[model samples]
Target: MLQAKAYFDTHHHVGVIDQRIFSGFLEHLGRAVYEGVYDPESPLSDEQGFRRDVLEALRAMRMPLVRYPGGNFVSCYDWTDGIGPREQRPVRVDYAWKSRETNQFGTDEFMAWCQETGIAPMMAVNLGTGTPKEASALLEYCNLPGGTYWADRRIQNGHEQPYDVRLWCLGNEMDGDWQAGHVPAEVYAQRAKAAAIIMKGLDASIETVACGSSGRGMSTYLHWDRTVLEYCWENIDYISAHRYSENRRGDSAWFLAEGVEIDRVVEDYAALLNYVRGVKRSQKRVYLSFDEWNVWYKNMEMDGKGESAPHLLEEVYNLEDALVCAQYLSSFIRHADVVKVACLAQIVNVIAPLLTKRDGLLVQSIYYPIVSFAQHARGLSLVPALECPTYKAGERGDVAALDAAMSYDEASGTVAAFLVNREQRQEMRVVLSLGDQRFCEVLSVEVLGGGDAKAANTWEEPKRVTPRSAEAHVNEAGELIVTVPAPGLAVVRARVSKR
Candidate 1:
């Protein structure tokens, strides 16, 4: 039998886990807005036209924050076009996704959804075809008290109180050639700096994020980041990073090793952030916001046809994809000190975890792991020392068969360990060591994966790929022993005491 050991020390910790790390994103592309979150025509929708089923799922995820308006859709978007009465709202062509965007669900609508869900808004402005003044005015409209022009306009739009949104993204992927109004790094840096100044001047409490590279695959990846930081490091509070993984190569082992890629990318960017701080010798520190990330290579074609709520980029996640998503949450927890915020590229329909149908929705396989970590992995991040067997995964080199991260909640004295077994056909015996801490009780041991790697949750079989409770016990040595299945993600929760 394959064997491994995971050692955890309650005293050694990374940092307080940011609940925003489990945050999600919602863009205007596809049915994420119209049909997914705001389906007025559906019988399941509430009085406000928001889908009750979708809101219930999102609320259960317990996401502290959610990014809104656009992934690429905000580039050519005008905030004013989305406010005021829906009858008077204009329908415009979305240049990014090549779809029709009705201004019906604008700033007020998004704010209403956020309020309903109790999730804070991470607003992104239009820096692509928009100017710095426009960015500041949008900030004024959302955050300022109703004495000014934009604030008064917001009040006239039926929202009397300010939105008071704290987190602001300057733009989306400014360095990507695919982005609307894409510009050189230097030009983007200057524009971002000016916008940051104006927005911050309007509301000194709000935090701003400068666009970093779209992904590490871009030719301008780190170079773009360096130039932007070199120019606007002082003005920005955080830099953004977007990444998406796929199994297009048909290599399962290499695909499962994506956690390696996520870890290295975060480390590299965190180092770059530190380097910039040193170069400028500034007291102000900027962290990373992995604002856009998910598995998104399967549905590369856009079938929108310039219509409303068209299907586009709706990638159905499978068992293998669930393991990767778990690894994503694990990596974010591991680097809690540097990576402060991360939004799972989308929340529903458009390359998301929950798939919505006109009648109902299917909770994809990826949703299990995401919810597991979001709900259980809280408090301090405990460093887990692992001695596990490794396999050579193509270009990723010697990848560990076991990927894991542990967290401890001091108030409850509970220790939750998130583990992923990467081997395809071999179940591994894992001995979880708590060192001198005494294991009090086993709360739960839930495992996901072990069936077909390509198995997914469809509308016909919604519960086809769900997690199952596994048996776990502690030995006389006080070490927890559990058998993690091949190609599986497991969450082991227990109460520990240091008597």
Candidate 2:
């Protein structure tokens, strides 16, 4: 039997959990916007053309924020074309996705949607193919409370009040050559610094995020991060990082272990930020915005095909993908200090947890972990010391079979632990020790596993692979014992009385 031990202390706090870390992203890619989230033609849509089914699905996840209007789509996008009446909104060729851009859904539509769903809007300004003046103008349009040109335009357009969006992205992946108007680190940094200065100048309350390397695999990687931070450090409040996991090699073990890679990325980026802070000798600190992340690899076939194909990037997630997603959330919880905000890239149809059809939607396997963590993993993050059995994976050698993260709620005295068992066959028995804290009772225990790694949900069968309640109990010695199945994710909540 595989064995693991976890120790959690209330005083050893990692960071205050940011609710925005449980955010989602919606882009104008594939069916994410037109058909997935806002389908006026569909019978299931609301009067305003918002898909009611999709809205309900998103509401269930309790997403705190939703990033809008782009991914690669923002790089070449003209924000002005998307505003005003739907019929008057111009249509352009989206060079990034090779699709026709219908500007029907713009900033106004997004704000309306956020209001309907009770989610905050995190907008991204177009840096590529757009000017800093335009970026500042867009900021003024959304934030300034009427009086100025853009602000008055917004008021005249329909919304009398401003959006007052707090979080803003400078650009999307400026380091990638494939991105429209992609520039070198120095050039992008200068542009971002200018935009940050202009937007913050317009409204001192808004926070800015400068684009870092697209992923760790980028040729520049940390160097891009360093250069961007060095140039735009004071102007920017957060630096952005984007990552996507895949199982191209068909190795389940290795694919699941890839979750640890995210942790490593966060650590390295945090270290880089620390080094930059020291080099600058500045008192201000910068946090990370993991604004775009998901499992995306199966749908690259139709990329660059242009308007001829509209639905090219819808990826169906599997059981293993869900496990990996849990690990990703666990990593975010573990590094809450540095990672203040994260948006699950494209939250509706394009590589998203909730997939939508014309009539309704399907909750993918990855959706359960997202719901669980978003609902329960709140309050202060705890640094849990863990001892577990090890396994040797191909490239990610000597990996821990079990990975765990814990959160403590002082007001309610609730302790929630998220555990993942990476082993393929063995059922690991876990012993959790809460030092100097008396265990009251197990509030809830849910495990997401049992199906094949490739198991997934379809339109016909939406509940094929989901989480189920597990058996957990607190022993006489104040230790909680639970068995974690292989290739599984478990979330446990218990009431604790402080001694």
Candidate 3:
């Protein structure tokens, strides 16, 4: 049997534990904008053109914030095209997603949608085709006290009050060659610094994120982060990172261990944050924003048609992706101190865990782990010690035999354990030690299990991949043992009556 432990120590429970790590993204490319969030004619859409079913699903996740406007779309995006009137708005080509972007749902519409769905908006500006002046105007339009030109324009467009959005991204992946207007690291750092100064000048309360490398494997990953942070370290509050994964090789064992990749990236980025902090000689520590991440590249085909106007980045997730999501959630909670914000690449049909049809929506396999952690996992991250043996893939070398992250939520009086079992045909017995704490009850046990790797949920039979619960007990010394099946993700919560 392998042992893993999480302890509740008051000293370990630190400052404000933000649930914003449970945030999401909404880009203009796919059904994410058109059919997913903003279809006026859908049977399930509300009066505001927001999908009622999708809103309910997102409300259930209890999302704290959602990044808006673009993924790659924001790179060359012109925010002005979507603002004033629906009738006069341009039908522009979206080169990034290979679709036509109707400027109907711009800043005003998105803010309204966020208000209706009860999710805060974290806006990313259009540095790809925009200037510091243009970015400043947007900041004034959404956040300034309604008096300036942009502010008056927003008011004239039906918003009488300020949106007062406090979070901003200076640019989206300006250092990546794949981005629409990729800039050299030096040029990007300079522009990002200037933009941060202007955006903050518009609203001092706003926190800004400067661009880092697109992902861990970028040739300029470390250098770009270092160079950008060196220039904007004192100006911005966070540095952004984006990554999309797919089982290109489809090697189940190796693919299941992909969560380790997200972690290694985050942990290394955390180190970069520290390096910048030391160089600046400041105690005002800056954190990281993993603004975009998901199991994408599955639906993007090389020879596929440009399809049509909302070339929906639709991906039907599988059981394996769920296991990967669970392990990645563990990584987020494990490093909660540094990674203050994260968005699950998207919230709807565009490679998201929540899939939607015209009338109804279904939760994908990955949804279970993300929702479970967002609902129950909070508090200071505790170092979880695991004594599981190791596994190896064809050249990937010793991956974690078992993947998990443990944290104690003092307010809820529960110790949450999120774990993933990636081993094929092997049920590993995991002994969870609660570390000398008395429990009140077993609050919950949520697990996503399937008979095969390709298991998914469908509109006709949506509950095929939802989480199911089971009962477990702790002994007098505070230990609960269970066997984790292959390709399964589990979250166990034990309550304490004393707290």
Candidate 4:
């Protein structure tokens, strides 16, 4: 069933649009940082020893900013151990990844890799097993100009210059039991507040992300936000949120419902931010950094396997998962109004869109929508409200509908519409009407689909599930009716003439 809704407004200047929302993340969990992005022996390596193939992929996507060196791994990590000589560097157990942590690819390697990939670093501190003093030392090591002690030691380690990284995370996931030095909400709040203060005291130029509950479903979610903000309301520039959808329901309805839940997480955070701002009676707005997000379920059981065997976080993705990924990315752009920054969990090899091997990296089928959105959807994120058509997916709990977003770029004189259809076997002929103005023509249409909802891509056949163009056009009524395929994601670009 194809349904339609139309509305428009001009003055919705909601939030500061941070280009970092297009940013990706690189953690030391899987091959994401080590053999994934940097392998010295690879023939495709650049001068800095970063993989050229991976660099080219990132460059093509133009992922301008990224978070580095730890997800949960940041908790127990000692920044000092990995800074100096390669031989003297220690190899310890990575409780997070359950692998032997070789100090070979520490801060310096990451900074170099960031340079090669052309991404700014958003580093996270070790609040789990380390102290505020240790956090300050790392800031000095990375951002301070060449000087005595930390800066000089960075010089002695063969890198005479400072990295000058401007963004930092206070801690990884302080409220979660899985984190190494996990503490109570109040304890984490006090520690995160103190860390933000000192971290700011050390480098006022950098922006800090204070830890909120790891996700909305966490036991300490609400209290964690309130307590953390009580101490960090002023020092921190942004509050962080992390979430991943695990589809145990194994049906379209479950997937659909969980998808809405992810957006609800963002909605909840915005509300929390508003509440705190009112309580403090402060004018400063605390933005959100969704530094961790993606469709992850590959390593669920690996957690019980033990830390030394840190579950290899590699997730072999399929067609359904990729569609879910596209839907999530669309949600990010749609809500980019409040979400200043979002890191798509680990961007490569480890629970990611693009997979890498020794020979070269393969662009997953899911990578297209992300690339199109990231490159094209940079202009005004106009608030596009929709009366989404509903259906009873076996995830929506009887909520049947469509998920969509639109961006009108003034410079390009174009309107880009991203839409996803959740119901099985139903094509949506949505009348995309311009509520206030007129669009001359719908110039391009990119559609991603599958013969069956469960179809996917594999190593033997990479194109098993990919999007294809369909019958779509605009009518004289100035309404755009495009066929949105079942379980498909569509991007329509149009050029507007005049009133």
Q: What is the C-alpha local distance difference test score of each model?
A: 0.91, 0.89, 0.79, 0.76
- Tell me the tens digit of each residue's lDDT in model 4 across 337-392: 66888888778888877777777777776676677777666566667667776677
lDDT of 3 at 38: 82
RMSD of each: 1.1, 1.2, 2.2, 2.4
Residue-pair clashes per prediction, in order, are 0, 1, 0, 12
After superposition, candidate 1 runs with Cα above 4 Å error? none
Model 2 bad stretches (over 4 Å) = 302-304
- Candidate 3 global TM-score: 0.94
**Model 4 misplacement above 4 A:** 5-16, 301-311, 469-471
Task: Give the C-alpha miss distance for residue 17 in model 3, angstroms.
Answer: 3.7
TM-score of 2: 0.98
| Pairs with backbone N, CA or C atoms under 3 Å apart (clashes), candidate 3 | none
Misplaced by over 4 Å in model 3 are 1-16, 302-308, 497-499
Model 4 TM-score, 2 decimals: 0.93
Highest lDDT against the true fold, candidate: 1
Summarize candidate 2's per-residue lDDT along 1-499 as a digit string, tens digits: 7999998888888878988889999988888888887888899999999999888878988889999887888999889998988899887888888888878888898899999999999999889989899999999999999888999999999899899999999989999998999999999999999999989999999999999999999898999999999999899999999999999998888887976899999999999999999999999999999998889888874464556227777888888899888988999999989999999987888888877778878889888999999989889999989899888777888898888999998899998999999888888899999887967799999998864888899988888898898889988888899988787888999999976
Ranked by TM-score, the better of candidates 2 and 3 is 2
For candidate 3, the lDDT comes to 0.79
